[model samples]
Target: MTDNIWTYLMVGITFAIYLGIAIWSRAGSTKDFYVAGGGVSPLANGMATAADWMSAASFLSMAGLISFSGFIGSQYLMGWTGGYVLLALLLAPYLRKFGKFTVPDFIGERYYSQTARVIAVFCALFISFTYVVGQMKGVGVAFARFLEVKFEVGVGIGIVIVLFYTVLGGMKGITYTQVAQYCVLIFAYLVPAIFLSLFATGNPIPQLGLGGQVTDGAWLLDKLDTIHTDLGFKAYTSADVNTVDMFFVTAALMLGTAGLPHVIVRFFTVPRVKDARLSAGYALVFIAILYTTAPAISVFAKTNLISALQDKEYADVPQWFTNWEHTGLLGFEDKNNDGKIQYYNDKNPDMDAVAASNGWKGNELTIDQDIIVLANPEISQLPAWVIALVVAGGLAAALSTAAGLLLVISTSISHDLLKKWLKPNISEKKELLAARLAITVAVIVGGIAGINPPGFVAEVVAFAFGLAAASFFPAIVLGIFSTRVNKEGALAGMLVGIVFTATYILCFSVFKMGGPEDYWFGISPKGIGTLGMIFNLVVTLVVTYLTPAPPVKVQEMVESIRYPKGAGAAQEH
Candidate 1:
């Protein structure tokens, strides 16, 4: 049978498992819908959080970026995964002890202001919506490529799957479902990585193989650097971006990871504040399994790709090459028409001399880095089963994250927006219904976005992080550490952070309103959140100093949440 058979079988099996979990663990009360009844075990929640955090960007895009960008890409591996350490130590426990259904709820109560709650809800929606669009688009791309369906149909299918589980069982279902997704995604990610690593180097372990000598007894990094230079590209292990830019970008991503609403809500599902800390540790271990492997996979995929295509006769190119080309993700032009292909950085001035000496016309290949993960298996001539598994894995990643983000959107709408303002006297059953209704609407919006996505997952997701870091991270941290941060200070800080970050991103990245010099201090819009966070901190402190301190009762609530000594069992209202 063709690969599509395995693709259908594996994807169908995974979806069935998810739906089964949803049906088995259906949510009844608001607490169950929002926080999985606050009873999940640490290990189970850990796996769920890993799945929720990884998303399509981590599973599909990171390796591709690292494959092309090389050494500088390590920042993502460190910034995104290492962030869990910061979360475990800094944020998770306090929020867990506060024992809220959502991050905005905690923010609202902690600040003791409805306006602060509203600000948090808005920030949460913006960040979660930005993230869900990527996942929904990933679902469309994965299904289109693997299932041989129209892109629209694939996206519709994905949205329906998510709506069925999330609308039906809410966080309670998503929690267990994500555990299964974690298993499927991790297995699919590791299998090809191990095979490719063993093929490229003598070592079977990918982390060690990344540093190990190649078949020619050359250090892997050394060999890649040689290839990079020969192709008129920067050395594979060199920093392509400026140092200051990378530092700010990495810091923004780290803070964003700690602040993202959906990921933060995972700890709320666990039974106790201590379990939240332990779950962060366990979640980091699960995430590290992939984060550590991705760079190795990047090197392996890039090296294998160059080796396979460079200087090879066009007529003799493999079917996988032609397959991807048909999708327009990979392209070629027979410029020289000498029946052979040449792939290099033709824009490099030094390449003009090389092209002249080799009688080459121009660079013929145009491959999008986003295609690397999906195409890696095909390029390796791996078994059809493996390719199908990767398709399923990509779906798992996209679906798991979409489910989480949809929950965030829904919870905020029902709990923070409607429940707080319109219908304070609503019953538990009606609240559950409202949450489901909100999910249906969110899924429709997300599907529409998937049809016309904003940009690449990695790039757009960075913007989401920037928004989260700028809007929420500072206020939340200050609220915990300093009881004096009153409502006006928190509100002013959020408005300043969000407006500054959004305007910066809109000017530079979205509108292309300015060039590199137009960026503030040469910091890319993606990294501007670090500056925004600092601004929020400063403005919040200044405003707090200018205003009266928080009332005594509010100060006591902050004090109660600071320590874990009497955290007791997780309590839900």
Candidate 2:
């Protein structure tokens, strides 16, 4: 497909808009850089938060996971969207009312100790760094594919783009740019889904298209279930999900969403506490648009792939097939020399025998299922501009997330560490310069990591979520609502939670020693972090009771934060 001029024009227009916003809303002070002067509208803040939350994982990976996993993939759908609900009900309002520049600030002042703040800062940094690696990798992948450049060069370009606005505009610049990104990504995601749905099932809405009958008047999911079972794969609608693991993954995702420093910090950008609460609902609504469409897209893409490939012989495949194969995304081997692509359960004995009899060795079609969603338009013969838009949308999703995380990381180093710890009397000008330097260094490191990510992007993100769930969620929740919670307890809780969660993940995930055979009490490291959260809650409550209550002055400050109406309020500027 030729590069469509319309797609290039659209992408160019989007870039110009982003650069314009960065120029218009450039930050001049610490407050502006950190929290966007706390003057963003509720709706606008909601859009920005949606953009921040919907990273490369959401845009590039979620539907792919769903396509491969079927109903079991609902875990991601439930876990990710349900998190916004938990944030809306449990965290957003109170945190916004607390009105701080950073999440660590709340911890520092709430516990009346620098120790609590430092610990929170560390957790924030850990979660942000791990998550950003995935986004950076995503940026590299999108750019490499769309621009036909080396992965490292794509990563460097992505880093430079994020650094330009992130250093200048901070949260203020990010907020507006993210709003633009949200538009680009959502349109890019939905357009093809709608086209595919209409083409396949005569329905524009994917949720309906998935369940509605296909052209043959059979329910799409039911047909998919039949095909899946025939190939020894799990049913489309009746996947086997471990209840316990499902519960933990869902809960952990919720806690992590509420605990994420970059996301929670967006609430502070709103002008009022009520606005924060309302905006969370709006964010969820915006996110749900894509979430609801994802399942349909998953089913559609999977069905289309099987139908397209089931009858095509290896020697007769088209140019598009070889093109994708060159990218290492599609592969096949005629193990038994039948010269046909056999796609089935590789481990299923019955299916293996059948494949062997037919001169096939296991499931030889080696296409990565994750490519389905992004490649849907091309597979279905959509216009080139639509393809280009997909490229732009993916880049937007990745860049927006990277920008947000870079801001959080830079703030932690510049404001929390340098000005607060080492040099208390640093001038404002020096502080701003330090913040930019920190951002530059961070972008460089992130770019390098993107070029050579240490682990699977999905697995790393999961671990990051687990870490946040275990460490920051408990401390933040207790800090605001529990007036009796003291410094000793909060600090201890953070340390214990962080240590336990890190150890659990490290043992199983990094060391690879905690599979089912070696799992501790049937709790794998991936799920054990949820257990750590319970431990944190218990330890914090018990320690708080055993220790003395927070000082009266601290209690008064908490009360003031809860209710607003004073000139001494923490102003953004």
Candidate 3:
């Protein structure tokens, strides 16, 4: 079959499966809507958790980022992977033992204040919305190329599909659908990876292929570095970013992963604390399969892209190039009126001589980094089915996370804001309606943001993680570990952390306030969340000491969740 036929076939099949699962598992009550009736098996929940955790940023953008940034981009790999470990070990079990429907539910009751709950709900909404923008963008990119539609139209399509499953099934439908998505996405990722690995290094395993020598008998990394330096870019193996900024970015991502509300709520779907831990372990294994292979994919994709396109005749370019160009994500301009392309680091001063000698006007090829993974199979001349499968996988990764995030947004409004705070006596049926309504609004808003994002997929996701790290991480950690942290401390800390981080991001990334020279303490907006987190911790600690401690019952509740003895017992709110 042609690529278009295969894409339509595969994507249609996957979407049908997702919709079928949603129909089969649609929630009938508030409990089912919020936590899948809180009876999910560990294995199923683990698969769902893995799918939820691996968003468009992980499947589509991480490898692309790593390919361009070289060793400096390992921060994303390290931070995100390390953060999952942190979440599994430090947060998941305790939160599950606490037996809350959502993070805000935990914070409100634990702090003994409706005000604290409201603050957490706000933070959850902000973080989830920011994160979903990346997913929406991923959806648009995939649909734009494979489905042959405008990016905005693609986003609108995604919003409708996600809204259908998310609103109808809620958490119940999302959980089972994610389990299927995990299979699709992982297979989609690994098949192309294995094919590229064999083509490049004669190895079937991508991990080993990364270290193996290429057909030219040179180590893959060494060859990549040569390619990069020849193009007037930094060596692919070298790290040029500041060490402090790297550390901060890594730490923020790690902390943010632990604090993400969507991931946290997954544990609530399971039956017991032990089940939560087990699911987390299973999720780690599933997640590592993709995460470990990412760098190898990065190396393969980068090497293949440059080899196929650099200085190539524009008229003779591959069909994939023309296909992607139709999406407006890839373009080539004959700047020097030379029919050949010039893809290089034009900003590098040392490349000036090279450009002049070669009669290169400038870097005339424009390739969005987000397209690398989607374009990898075509660049490597893989089969049409493989290319189509990748499209499905990318969509699976995107829609799975989008559903999870939209659920969080809806639950925050319907569960936290309306039911818990505004109208404690609201009917369960009315609350369910409210949740669906809230998600409908959220999907539209997220679709618009996807059409007009502030940055690349991974960069926008990093900002969301930063916001989560600065705001929710401190509050949750202190609430779990420190009984003395009163509502005042938690409330003040969350407000300060999110506000400061949001302002910093807005100034640098949104408003174009100043250059890197104006950064506070030499930290970029992406890494400033670490500083905000620190401020939150310090403020939380100081306020706890200055104000009265949490009530005796709240302190006892903290102590109860820490121990595993009675973790299976149901706790009263």
Candidate 4:
């Protein structure tokens, strides 16, 4: 069969399975739609949570980012996975014990104010929207190749598929679909890695192969560093960023993982508080399987890319070049009169002599970092079936995370806004209807944002986590830990945290007025969320001391959430 036909058949089979699950598990009431009636098994919930947490960025963009940035990218490896330990120990059990249907529901009652809930809803929406844009990037890249359409058009197609399953099935359907997705994505990721590892180092295990000697008897890292430096790029094993910038950025991402509404909500789905803790352990293990292999893949892919393409004539470029170029991710121009392709860092001043000697104008290749994983199989010359499977896996990552984000958006609106305020008397049937409509609106909005993403998939997701860490992490953690923080204090802290973080982002990213030099204490926009989180805690504690204490009942509720004894099932508060 033709490549396109094979892609269509493979993708069609996965979609069919997802659709069947959605139809069979169609939510019957608001409870099912919101939290799957709160009876999900721990193991099943762990698989689903792993799928939900590993978004398109995790599946596609992350390894690519690492391949380019080298050892510094270990920050992502540490930040994203380490945060789950915090989530399980500091956040998950208490949140589950609270028995609320949504994150904002807990904020609203624990803080004793509708205004606090409204703030939380806004935080959830903003973070989810930022994250959805990344998912769309994955959709665009994966679909564009198989369908032979513009990346933006592919995003539109992905939107329709996600909407069908999400609006039809809600949390229950998504949970099962995600379990399947985790399986697909993990398999797709590993197959090529094992193949490449064996090809390069005569080792089938990627993690060990990356550090082993290649066929030429030179260490892989040593060879890569020598080649990379020759091209004017930093060594793949070197750390080149400022220490302050690296620490805060990594810290923000780690804390933010615990605060994100979608991941946090996953803990609410398991059967009990103990199940929540166990599921987190399981989820982290599943996630680590991909995390550890990615850096090795990054090194392997980068080595192959340079060896294959560098200094080669433009006329002799591989077919993979044409395929990726058609997607607009790989760009080339014959800048110099020379017919040969020169893919080196032209930005380095030391390269001026090299360019003049070779009669090269500048770097003739432009490749987006996000394209690395999607292009890996082809770069390594894998079979057509493997390439098709990788595409399906990319879609699975994007659609699964999109489904989880849509749930957060719907719950924030239907439960926190409409039922809590506009129509306190709404029935379960009506609430379910509102949730579906809210989901439809969210998908449309998310799709629109994806068309003109603010940054690459992984960068956008990092910012989303930063926002979540700054805005929600402090309040949720404080509320569970201390009864002294009143509604007024919590509200003030969230407002300040969000505004401070957003202002910094706008200053550097939007207005372009404040450069990194203008950033506080050498902290970049990526790490500003750490400052915001600290600001929140300080403001909350100060305000609590100055104001009257919370009511005794509220204090009792705080203590109840903290203790593990007699923890009940998750319920619609």
Q: Highest TM-score: which candidate?
A: 3
When 1 and 3 are scored with lDDT, the better candidate is: 3
True-structure Cα RMSD, model 1: 1.8
Candidate with the larger TM-score of 2 and 3: 3
Residues 75-180, candidate 2: write the lDDT tens digits.
Answer: 7788778777888888777777776777887888789888888898898888898788878877876765665566667788888888898888888899999999
C-alpha lDDT of candidate 2 relative to the true structure = 0.80
Better of 1 and 2 by lDDT: 1
The alpha-carbon RMSD values of the candidates against the true structure, listed in the order shown, are 1.8, 2.3, 1.2, 1.3
lDDT values, one for every candidate:
0.86, 0.80, 0.92, 0.87
lDDT for each residue of candidate 4 in 417-451, tens digit (9 for 90 to 100):
99997789998888888989988988888888887
Q: In candidate 1, what are the lDDT values of residues 1-573, reduced to their tens digit? A: 687788889888988999999999999888888889888999999999999998988988889989988888877877787666877789888988887777788888888888899989999998898888888877877876775656677788888888999999889999999999999999999999888888889788999999999888899999989999999999999865788988888998989887899998898887777789888889989998999899998999998899999999999999888766655557888888888878989879989988888888779888867678888998988889999899899989989999999999998988888787568888778888888998898888888886766566777778888888899998889888888889889999998998999889878876788888877787988789989989988898899999999999999889888954656544444
Distance from true location, Cα of 376 in model 4, Å: 0.6
State in Å the error of residue 239, model 2: 3.5
Top-lDDT structure, candidate number: 3
Q: Is candidate 2 or candidate 3 better by lDDT?
A: 3
Writing each residue's lDDT as its tens digit, candidate 3 over 514-572 gives 98899888888888889999999999889889999888998999999887575553332
Worst 10 residues of 4 by lDDT: 564-573
TM-scores across all candidates?
A: 0.96, 0.94, 0.99, 0.98
Mark the regions of model 2 whose C-alpha exceeds 4 Å error after superposition: 4-7, 150-153, 451-458, 521-525, 563-573
**Candidate 1, which segments miss by more than 4 Å at Cα?**
150-153, 335-340, 358-361, 568-573
* Stretches of model 4 off by over 4 angstroms after superposition: none
